[model samples]
Target: MARNDVDLLDLSLDELLTTTRTVRKRLDLTRPVPRALITECLEIAVQAPNGSNQQRWNWHVVDEPDLRAEVAEVYRSGMSGHQADPNRATRDIDYSTEEQQRIASSVAYLRDHLHKVPALLIPTVGGRMDEADIFLQASVWGSILPAVWNFMLALRARGLGSAWTTIHLHKEAEMAELLGIDAAKHTQVGLFPIAYTVGTEFGAGARQDLADLIRWNGAG
Candidate 1:
């Protein structure tokens, strides 16, 4: 059996949790992510918190050239909407900072090169949630998100990087068709392009301070 625990005292658990940035342009598209590593990450991921211990995670890992191209096209087709949005075009103006500018430019780079990445992962679950009640919807997604987060964390620990992208979820059915997934039965959670980082020097990104966001009691 795979070990479920990492040695917190030996490993920089806090740093890993904090610095696993949403890697984009920095992902080394040229380097092939080893199949063993991907499997290892998934192994680690499956141990994440789930509802009723029912492990419902399903993965469609696209590594073949032809399928990658098709998936990328499908992802891009959906992305065109965001690309055409007026507000998105002016997002740089909304966040005027060197870091934000770098983020914007890198996002554009990924938009152009997503297909070329060494690996594309589509994480899914057994149930569809479109018409499900709030409880069912939350339970379904809640079971998957922790596993996905664990997968990302495992990848970062192994020097691999991937950005979780929801843009492709807009074309979920199309992607499901291409990947031979029965969309009626399974819900595609998101897309992730997996590759090595050009240089692994991640730092925490800016965020709202805990003090500002946290409240001692219920909403005022």
Candidate 2:
């Protein structure tokens, strides 16, 4: 597909939702992604409901070569020790050992090559929640996360892909300084690498049975 083309994938709601994979190795590094396409996705993204209708959010995009390289360096530094393994947090889940390895490999690949991705997006919301109460934290995150997911879905629809990554947050201060973001006034959500995928086809990922994972009513 041409960089300027806006031909979207013909996906139903469910297909769009289910197949929006966290792309890594598949990111098309050699091609350029049009800025207008990203703007179009953000247009859909901001439509997500936010707290009190106050859209105190900012989307920082780094497409310039030097800036993207610097940010990618910070991201690599943050993952220095973290990416040695797949997330231990998921160990308790039912994923097989092979699944874990596969995930870790893809993550490592992205970590090493993130600088080459076409664009990097960092979404921020107003105010810090470092010491805030659960209600406050929930309310704050509730506002921005929906929009981020919406953005991801919009990217999928437009033949682009990105992964929600927070490893860079370990060096959040460095990132903020580099990007000229005000750390005291806003919280950086996550880093998203935007690029057209090598292929548009994706399948649903593995998951535990819904019946086993879900709790109906008050049942545990």
Candidate 3:
């Protein structure tokens, strides 16, 4: 189908929600993601609101082979520590046997050739916050996360998929230098591999009921 003829509104809510999974193994690594599409998604993403209307977010897209390898190296160095951390490892949702194998294969592929993925998106925030100030830190992240998620949603609608991974930020300084990013001034919030999914169909994910997650006005 031609890009212009694609209708964003055609996607059902469930299709949007389910298909937007962290596409790792399913990423069509062999196919290339066009620059125009990435930019189109970003245009939609920036429409997401930020704190006090400060549109300080910036996105860096990496497509060169050399640069991708550098970023992948930095990510690998960090992944070891991140995977070792009990807190981090425990956070991943458990998968069924087939699903687990599929995810594991994808993760292994990423670990080995993340640099080969057609496009790498590094989302950044303009200002830095003191880590000691809890509220300030939260606000900084609050400003960028919404737009990032929106960017992912936009990609899904366009027949592309991405996974939010920060394993490379373990060596944020190295990654910043490799990408010519100023870590002190701008925070690289997350790294994602953007590409078309191998299959067009995606099902909804499992989650708890909203009532179970929400608290009553008086604390039941």
Candidate 4:
């Protein structure tokens, strides 16, 4: 069978990096995401390295109406506290007046209708690590972080957009029960909403120069 062709390497480093945005209100909530495409993306995700090659990762994709609603409820429930927090800031990233308005509008829309998005992905690990200290926590989470990133990159290359969200995990046990996630067996890492972006052209965001972040063996 002939396979579809596209130059993966041809995508400039900047383009690839810039396009991977944390999609929220810009997600095409009306369009449906086909299962086959999601499977293809996940196939790419598994190629990411796992700690000690354990390969013990699981992904749960929710598309059913009732389930999506349930997940959204969990997400909304978690978001309520943040929304109520007095210390939370509402500054916009875009500098222009119109751009700031647009950003604020998108955020408002997502907050209002997050439950209606097409799909949700909850990635999990097969085993739990003892939380003795920071190192132990890092060792367990380090295993899944790479694979999670690969999943997001694959989604971006395929014209999908997602945002890593742990807010819903605040009520992890409830979410687990609703999704039939075996929390006793697998560790739920985070939740992400997956959908085709309303637009594919995202610009590079502002970042500090490497010199400001990098350090030599000894501080100057």
Q: Which candidate leads in lDDT? A: 2
TM-score per candidate, chains pooled = 0.88, 0.92, 0.86, 0.83
Q: TM-score: which is higher, 2 or 4? A: 2
> Backbone clashes in each candidate structure, one number apiece?
0, 0, 0, 0
lDDT of 2 by residue, 92-122 (tens): 6654678777888898899889889999999
Which ranges in model 1 have alpha carbons more than 4 Å from their true place? Answer: 1-11, 84-100
How well is each residue in 41-140 modelled by candidate 3, as lDDT tens digits?
Answer: 9988999988899998889999998888888888998988787878985466676578777877878787886887899999999887746388888878
Instruction: Name the regions of candidate 3 deviating beyond 4 angstroms.
Output: 1-9, 84-105, 130-132
Candidate 4 per-residue lDDT, tens place, 87-175, comes to 64543334467866776576667767777888889999886654447876786688888888888887787678898877776677888
lDDT computed for candidate 4: 0.78
Local distance difference test values of all predictions, in order? 0.84, 0.92, 0.84, 0.78
Model 2 lDDT, residue 139, Cα = 97
- Lowest summed lDDT over 10 consecutive residues: which window, candidate 3? 1-10
Better of 1 and 2 by lDDT: 2
Model 1 lDDT tens row, 150-183: 9998888877789988888768889888999999
Best of the two (2, 4) by lDDT: 2
Q: State the weakest 10-residue window (summed lDDT) of model 4.
A: 1-10
